[model samples]
Target: MKLSTIALTIMLGLSSSTMAQPKDITIRLVETSDVHGSFFPYNFITRKAKSGSMARVYTLIEELRKKNGKENIYLLDNGDILQGQPISYYYNYVAHEKTNIAASVLNYMGYDAATVGNHDIETGHEVYDKWFKELNFPILGANVIDTKTNKPYILPYYTIRKGNGIKVCVIGMLTPAIPNWLKESIWSGLRFEEMVSCARRTMTEVKAKEKPDVIVGLFHSGWDGGIKTATYDEDASKKVAQEVPGFDVVFFGHDHTPHNSVVKNVSGKDVICLDPANNAQRIAMATLTLRPKTVKGKRRYTLAKATGELVDVKELKADEAFLKHFQSEIDDVKTWSEQVIGKFENTIYTKDSYFGNSAFNDLILDLELEITKADIAFNAPLLFNSSIKAGPVTIADMFNLYKYENNLCTMRLTGKEIRKHLEMSYDLWCNTMKSPDDYLLLLSDTQNDAQRLGFKNFSFNFDSAAGIDYEVDVTKPDGEKVRILRMSNGEPFDENKWYTVAVNSYRANGGGELLTKGAGIPRDSLKSRIVWESPKDQRYYLMEEIKKAGVMNPQPHNNWKFVPEEWTVPAATRDRKLLFGE
Candidate 1:
């Protein structure tokens, strides 16, 4: 054969082989956020196995990987994994000398990356710093910068390569509102930058340097576009998706609400945005299809389609091996949670707080007043409908009572400001009743569904005041609802008098905007107004108070009441049944 003919034949064979390769590839990305230490299919509060768990989520991930090919699947956690149940508390505080169970589980599940959450930072440097060091995968936090170095405190972002040489760059960002919710000592040397600004800067760098085929943002914030009183952007995931152009997909949590949609960017291109909710109840999945195109006789891939959805994991079965591997830790947590601290003389339920003052909230108020010796105390139910029966109160019961690791805070406020705060709370918590059939508690048809009635806002923010007598008139408008009667100690209420008020750090730091907006207090001056702050979480003090008392007999202070009892009482009773189906 001639040499020219042989060369031509070889070139043809090479071209044929290249053409045989697939023209397109589809990859699936899965995310879990706000895991909050739910590694097993068990609820510590109820002391029973439940459906939501990382173990169950692992099973779903495994099934999806098997169906979609392991190389084409990537798993990531958005954040809030360090603190919630006793399992995490044990590893974080009780058994700090050993390996972190949360990190170990993430490593075992083969996570690609994770973002830092405000609650994770609330665990303090010693806990999260140790956990971050031990994690197998990179934990990204581009906005959480160190003051000393003026650079990212953790891995700003990470890039992973698939089987087809497709590079996916995942960047992580946290809410800048950390300073507003957390104490300075917890995040001492770190500064959380605004999400939009940080995303713009990070995306530019990633596109320039990595030139990744896909850019995914793992944010530990919500989808709200509005700014809070403390930060430039508290929940700026939607803003980041709208303003930043490089991100192909954005996965967010922190609001604990499930959301999935495609948002239009500044360039008029669509970006996938997703939030899987909290405690492994759901998982967010993003799928991208890349098609190969020949440019100058070289094959290149471009994203053809991107879509996102939230998958509910309520019915998924837990992975047996995953559960078995961590059975000892599970048992340890169970035993610790069951240890009786003290006894409650009567059952305390949160349902009563919705209508009038309940022992459930009054107990918290009592602890705050006792701990701080403040002139007045304010509190709200952190959980919507949690209850504790009359019996021995275990460590787990405390978790049910106090949902978050919030510290006790006492600030100075005038009587007028306190009244304004109550007015705001009542406005959000109650509705104007024109007749006896009208609903006493605020009910929004827009927020409710066929399954259950939902409040316009979180019921946890429905605050009530103690140490003073007041009345909420359901027939009046919002600003005119709350009327101060007198002090609980039989003294006349003075609107001009300054008094110390004890509350949770979240309230004092403007989490619900009651203190800053309602009270008309300057956000920057809030820290200086602090009369006293608890060194540990409020739950810690509650446990100590319980241990010291040995017998807890929680009773309502009866300082506040709803007016026009003839109309309000029946309406509240009917609404309670409608809300709880009891």
Candidate 2:
């Protein structure tokens, strides 16, 4: 009787399988990362028409949802959404009582899920915490752990069931190197785990709990090699996809470089990885198709095809509905942006900063020195190929002048440590100058490098010092290029004696590894090295100073210059032409 019952059950299962043909299931995930508050087709800072924005992105998303059933479409954002436009500032600081424009806009756009970016954390607990609560959809962070509760800080992963009964899961994580760049107070009670470790553990739980047919990874870290340590990598999305075995699609951002490729996991199964880059310029779309596979005489759904592509939002027209719906908010932002703070006597261009000193770079350096009263001030071309017209300097113009809300830090450093920091900076900024004809800048023509604010290296890390008279010799190599003669006060520079140096919080926090690796200061020991820290962002002080002065005239310090004029003069001229025509 037992043998007959087993035979009948097996026969009935086979008959049911033969009678019913399982249909193919599809799930489409569209992602945006590093939107950076470009919500409209206009640049609030420049007050001009820009190429891409969330308005334009909305148009494309609407069309995508229409073509593919809305039930099968999932919209996600990787991160870096809370900073950048003057409008964002208007909502973040000025209109603090109301719902943040970022959360409100995303809610209106119907974003299914999002991840908090490093920049979002920079807003501190007050802003990001409020923004986090305001979001309609769950903000995901598998690696962001709450130390108090010892649980996931946010919704680690979100799962949705498609109309065809295909369970799709999306996992989110940010880089573990947040502490290396941000202050402790900002990310208080939050600890970031390494991507691979978190991904592996999270995958195990997700596989057992959700039993998802399709899995997607939405990460905020770059592809590879941002900040490498023995324990963690700042950009480890690619590494996780390669090591973890479950993902069908992985989307990442924060490097601001577009990528669409495939990586094989430990199981030798292909995982599609996509990045849309920054500023709402593009959207990464991934499609997953699942088909039934016979396993042990039972049917199970598995990923049959996974594909990804980046769709450009630049060419798409802005949705009128989006603009009209938020017209009142846009007008309010414009009112705040147009409030004139000061005036400029002369026009300054950041393009001139690449070759050597420029009025724009000097203005910021001078501000740092005066504000901190330090012996030396380090400044970078944060503006990066922008210009300030010789006219009214409004709040909007300040955003263009100083790109980030980095606080000024005054740190104690020996003359030797200072020199080493500059060595690292110049190494990344300029070439070896093997010959006069060789490009002075280490220009990389690769697509990814060129997209980095028109420089081979990130221009924000191209730090130059004021209050010291120095010359960069074109004939020397990276470490030997800088030659310091004397301090600006004509005092003898001593490598053994400690001196107060002024820098931005980003540098002090080891944003570019200049302080830790170049200056030989340990990351944990940086706070002790600080002599003083500005109460607010350096830009705030700069604005106050400008407001007090009413009319500001900025000039290059000319305290430092390039040596071997025969080599430097021609190289600077030739390279400027190569970089920007005419």
Candidate 3:
């Protein structure tokens, strides 16, 4: 019989036993990860679709509480709660002057504990520190430690005694990749221990010191592969099962894949692991039954099999009262989004290439170049949203496009840095440009260089604009030959010149390990010094910008080309069979 089937049968048979009867002690873990500060149900794109909203999630949590009683439940956020949507920006910046609505809503929801995600660090330490003070729940992470202070920045682990007096040890763990991905400044003093080691150390400590009956891992680290082989994260969870000796259940997050499976550890014992995807769309439910006993002279417990499912929110009734309050926030955001700030005579489009030029990308570069009046400009193409249709765009549209709420900032880059940037782009495309058959356009071919570029140079210039052109030479490796030919103005770009480029404040400050390091360029992009008269809402600006361009029709601009310097013609590079001969 399948493990789940057998486990279920065992539980059913033991259901009404005097010793196994359902005790007053029940534990329900409701988790939401990678919410990214989406408190309002605003699309920020079409401003139509009902998504990225915490109101609905809040309603669902309320319903769960009603059905399962709050005294027996714990609401936990798996992390990445601080970034993603514009409300994060609204709360971090605009609402900095007021109480953060996102925090208010989460606090109101009564979260018991949470772990951090890498994106949460993007908010910078000061902001995070300030906001953390407002949280009622203990933020847990055994791995994230301050090198200078020699203490974990967040609570490493804590134990909770549930209603029926079941002492459960909850250990939180954040991914160790935080330092490698976030801006250097934000993570300067932070050091992450390997996930498995951290879990082992903490769980061993808890077992020896506290000896909780049920040990639950509120792991913010993700499950890397299927349940069998150890992905660094899986090693951590499985190790907890084997080394720690008493782990009953593990709740996972960060990777956003939903799964509930039993992982057999080195000792050939089983541990239950659960992960439900992000955005508050689903909840992971694991029901456990335990029979308390005194073995010899010590209290021992019998733990049941771990079985779970991703509870679908669509099937639940939304809390209407909560929805009404969240709806008001949405309405305010919408009203703020509708006001037009600029106009355009032509329709300007962004590029749609998985790996080529985009008019949508052009607008962002244009804005960067124009704002700084730089000789050349750069920004990541993935940052943009889906292409807009013809008509008046709104602030909501801009927010949707730049969904991450990356503030604008300016940075100076030297000619050499510029060349390095373009070369990196080429390297990115070359890595994935495997044309086994020249006739077949590989579906894996993508447009943005940064997507595949291994190098982390090239700072941001956030002046989003309407017209720009450039070609990248992708053939050469980093350091010498990669080139950028300016296409926006159809001019032979000067290589020896320095340009002031505007970019999102995050990138300007070297978020994503941008070229700010050792580039010798002065950063004038500090939040206080930068002048931003535009409201937090961007839909109006997007509409205004599009209107100025008029009659939007984007043409192929391969003029900015990247030919490989060291070209390798693969053995399978022969032309493929064409369905309709071209």
Cα lDDT, all candidates: 0.87, 0.88, 0.57
lDDT of 1 by residue, 102-139 (tens): 89999999888898888899888899999999999899
lDDT string, candidate 2, 1-582, tens digits: 999999999999999988797777677889999999989998999999998899999999899779878887889999899998888777877898999999989999999889989998888889999999999998999999999998898999998765666677889999889999887877999999999999999999999998777888999999987888999999999999999999999999988889999999989999899999999988999988889776788656887787889999996999999999999999898888898998999999988887788899888888888788899989888755789899999988888789887788999999999998988888888887877788888787654542464567888888889989888886787688888888999999988889999999889888888888887988889989987888777778888888988998899888888778888889999888877775
Clashing pairs in 1: none
- Per-residue lDDT of 277 in model 1: 82
Sort the predicted structures by TM-score, highest score first.
2, 1, 3
Query: How does candidate 2 fare on TM-score?
Result: 0.94
Model 1 lDDT on a 0 to 1 scale: 0.87
Better of 1 and 3 by TM-score: 1
Best by TM-score: 2
Q: Model 2, residue 173: what's the lDDT? A: 97
Ranking by lDDT: 2, 1, 3
TM-score of 1: 0.93
